[model samples]
Target: MERFLAISPKSQLWLFHTALALNILGMVLTDMWEPMVVGAIVTTYLSIDATVRVRYVLPMKKVLRELEQENASLRRKMADVEQSSAY
Candidate 1:
């Protein structure tokens, strides 16, 4: 909004918010349809990808590292898989 933008003029999120607001305004102001739908889809995809990386891909890395350790143990690269050591 004009108030938020006035307060923090440099924020990228605010910039995106402002653009989205302007996009909606344009749809009503010019009575366009396709552009508004495209705008909605773009923001939706960005949000979905952000959610997926934070929720799944990051945790998968830890599981992957564990699997790599297990695979290496199966190959006998480690000295002793039974030895007690801090993970």
Candidate 2:
């Protein structure tokens, strides 16, 4: 098992593909068809959430905080710019 989550979009897709392939392969090998398709979708979605939690969720919290701060900064700048630009 990989210890790190995939951060790049390319890796994200590959992870999903890999998950689906594995799920399908396991199901087909066992001669289960209906469950295989459903399992593939479930595993793909779970893989996305799992990848996000492992890779970006924590860092995204901090990014949200930073963006909140930047929002205020931008608002202040916009106010000044608008005031100056007002005819």
Candidate 3:
């Protein structure tokens, strides 16, 4: 699960779609469908989870980056103020 989450979301979605296709093929072409069904289920879950997590995380990442930029600017301003006061 951790390893699945660690993979890129694009790759995860692609893998899920591939697994689904294979599952459908297996159902039509093979007597052995159990493994493919299981694979489809697992890949589907991973894809959904990765997409949802990425959706939640991206906005937070942007917000954190903005906050860091603001913090740096404030620090610079504080340094300038301190220097003027010393003079």
lDDT by candidate, in order shown = 0.62, 0.77, 0.76
TM-score of each: 0.45, 0.42, 0.60
* lDDT digits (tens) for residues 1-87 of candidate 2: 334444654466567768887998888688887888898889888677656764777578789999999999999999999999995
Clashing pairs in 2: none
lDDT for position 50 in model 1? 45
Which of the two candidates, 1 or 3, achieves a greater TM-score against the reference?
A: 3
> Could you give the candidate ranking by lDDT, starting with the highest?
2, 3, 1
RMSD of each: 9.8, 7.8, 3.6
Using TM-score, rank the candidates from best to worst: 3, 1, 2
In terms of TM-score, which candidate is stronger, 1 or 2? 1
| Candidate 2 lDDT score at position 1 | 30
**Candidate 2, poorest ten consecutive residues by summed lDDT:** 1-10
In model 1, which runs have C-alpha deviations exceeding 4 angstroms?
1-33, 77-87
Supply candidate 2's per-residue lDDT for 62: 81
Residue-level lDDT for 26 in candidate 3: 78
Off by over 4 Å in 3: 1-31
- Clash count (model 2, backbone only): 0
Clashes of each: 0, 0, 0
Clashes of 3: 0
